[model samples]
Target: MIDVGLLLTMIVAVGVPSLVARWWPLTTFGEPVGFLDVAIWPAMVGLGVGRLVAVALDGPSSLGSLSDLLIIRSGVEFWPGVAAAMLAAAWSAHRSGVASFDRLADLVPLALIGYAGYEATCLVRDGCYGPETSLGIRPPGTSTTMLPVGILAAIAVVVGAVVLHRQLGRRASWAVVMGGLTVVAGVRSLAAIWLPHIGDGLTRQHWSSIAVLLATVPALTAGVLGGHPATRERQLLDR
Candidate 1:
């Protein structure tokens, strides 16, 4: 039987971001860019690439058949998906004649909120259980009391989204993008420590997060030193 709940979850994962990105008033160099028009490209490409990456990481046994591979209700790796989506967004922005970095910065808030929405779905999904603890809720069909990490993560990211949104009113600079990403990566690294099955010491994700955190510093500096205007909207707003 088709898992309707999972299907809905997937829809929200893709739809919420796309809708937000679409309606989002993304401006670059004092001009409006129709990110709303190209939102679906990134969403679809990210989902496809993320699913493929997950299957590859899981090995051949997880592949099963071509039909099975097409089933995307489960088995997605987060970082890979995010990377693919970013690449897609960059390409889309370029094709639309908008500078990529500004658009990406504008996209950060939507990404955070979208992640929160995805995590909300995890509250009911079969997996994403956190480490067992007294301060946790036992998900359906599971005896162990697992932390409500999904909801907590959702709340956390929602807060982040609000902060970033307020920081960037109608336009975005590369500095904002790098800073937001750094914060988010750090948060993810910290949160992953409490995930079930995480072993002692730094894992690949931790290393990746650290690398991202470090890399952003120079990028942020460059962005700031370059004297890029945070918002370039003319005093007279577009009608």
Candidate 2:
């Protein structure tokens, strides 16, 4: 049987962005970005990529049938999903002939909120546990007391999103995209500290998170130091 609770949560997670993006008033290169493209395409594409990646990582034995692969209850790779979603968003913007960076800035918070909501569902589902820890509370039905990595990561992402929205949402800048992603990748890195390594003393998530942090931090710094060209242009146009 399908998990009704998780299914509903997923729907809400995706739905909120789709509804809100319709009226959020975002633009790229002085043109409005398509709401459905921003809010829906990335998420759907990401889910598919994440699911496939997870199954591949787990090996063919994990894939019982086409139906099994289709059902997300099995597992999904979080990092791959995020990367694919971002690519999908960029592609959507590109297809619409927009520069994408400014549009991405406005969309970042909504994406983070939706991501956090989806991760929150990890609390009730299997396959999201952290390494066995005697220090923290144990999830129900599990004998080993795990670190509750999923919920903690979800909380961290939500907090990051709120902070980003409050601090930078008023102005459209590349910082929103870079900063939001930095926070998320940092959270993933932290979570990886408690997760068991698949190989080489680091989980794939850890490597991915580190890579993102490295790429985004410098870009975020430069954007802040130089000021967003779009924001500056907007200021000049207003004057």
Candidate 3:
């Protein structure tokens, strides 16, 4: 069982800064750097390392086993997903011509908040709660008591959307929202791996999950790149 209080605390820690950014946006005297720019790489690096380690030691098959699922559900996958999405979103923002890195720094705090919230959801769902353990505190109906990584990812999404909104305007906000939903769908699709034998079967469920991930990579890239400052500035200047 995971400690709900600690899980919530983690979410708050990551999330509040982003909300604060909305009000007291980060600034170097007066420049704005989007929230995604700051938080994306760090979150991604953390997630990439965790996933790489798990895959290296246990293989992909260990990803959705009951024990593994507990970990995933606990938000183990949150940071990686946030990292990937943030990178993708940042690239999209840069390409969109919405704002420069200097102008966007203020947005990082908000994105962190969203990532935290997302991970908290995972903790409640027991997605990555880990196996039974005798150490630390455990929540009811769970073996291990650890914070989920998804909370951080969710915080990223929330904050990312705000940053996109601030930089790219409403259109980018919509894109962020859509992209976030797609990621959720992809996660759900992958979650089927937890189902007994369903994951073992060669079917669309697995393929769909892979497809979503594959699709997300390019879509996110394009979104970020397409939203670059030079491009948007030109578009605005033209209009």
Candidate 4:
């Protein structure tokens, strides 16, 4: 039987943007229907790429045939899927004449909240987990040590979204949330440090997290300086 929890995770992750956008007050950057439009193709691409990357990373032992490789539902990585999807969505949005950055700005809060939903779903489904240790309280239902990171990740996102919502709606302020996520990545890495599964070496995400932190400095700085003045009119009245 198909895993109901996993199915729910996918649905919530994809449907979140639409749910959030449905009641949004007027804006120049996004249409109520635009989130799904921006998301659909990229989601397809992300799933394909994420599954392929998993196949490659897992090595030849797992794959008996090309047909097995085509099956994406069994394995997927969030970072690869998200990265690929974001790029695809960005390109697609640009091609479709949507204001890319502005839409992305609009997406930050929704994405953060959406991701929290993903983290919550992970509690029920086997998903991104951290090291085994007593440092953090175990998730209520699962014995997994990873829930702390998910909790922290959710907290960081919510905090960033709250912070951003108070801003004058500068597109650059969205980077502040990016920076917050970068910080969460570091927190996850630190949590993994005590994990037996990870060992002594820094994982790929650790390196990527550092890279994000490095990028975040400038992005946050630029946000503070006022980003893309052309977007000034799109601002939702400074609060």
Best by TM-score: 1
Candidate 3 structure quality by residue, lDDT tens digits, 23-129: 75655324665444456565656565555554545567765565654454233443345446555545655665544433233344354355446555654544544
Write one digit per residue (lDDT tens) for candidate 2, span 1-239: 77876777777677765665565545453666554555677878888999989898886776667887887866778778887887877886788686566657767867777777667776565545788777865766667877778788888987887776664534445677888889888888888787655566876667888998999999877766766566778899999
Clash count for candidate 3 is 71
| Candidates arranged by lDDT, highest first | 2, 1, 4, 3
lDDT of 1 by residue, 150-183 (tens): 7787788777777666667433366778767766
Clashes of 2: 0
TM-score of 2: 0.73
Q: Can you give the lDDT of residue 237 in candidate 2?
A: 98
Write the residue-wise lDDT of candidate 4 on 1-239 in tens digits. 77787789878776765676675432534444555655678778878778777777776665667888876666665567767866776676587687665555555556666666676566666554555566655655566654356656656666765565545254453664564455445545555554335457776656665665676667677766776655665585553
User: What TM-score does each of the candidates earn?
Assistant: 0.74, 0.73, 0.35, 0.71
Please say which candidate is ahead in lDDT: 1 or 4.
1
The better-scoring model by TM-score among 1 and 2 is: 1
- Candidate 2 stretches greater than 4 Å from native: 15-38, 60-65, 127-137, 143-147, 167-172, 195-200, 228-239
Task: Assess each prediction's global lDDT (C-alpha) against the native.
Answer: 0.71, 0.74, 0.51, 0.62
What are the clash counts of all predictions, listed in order?
1, 0, 71, 0
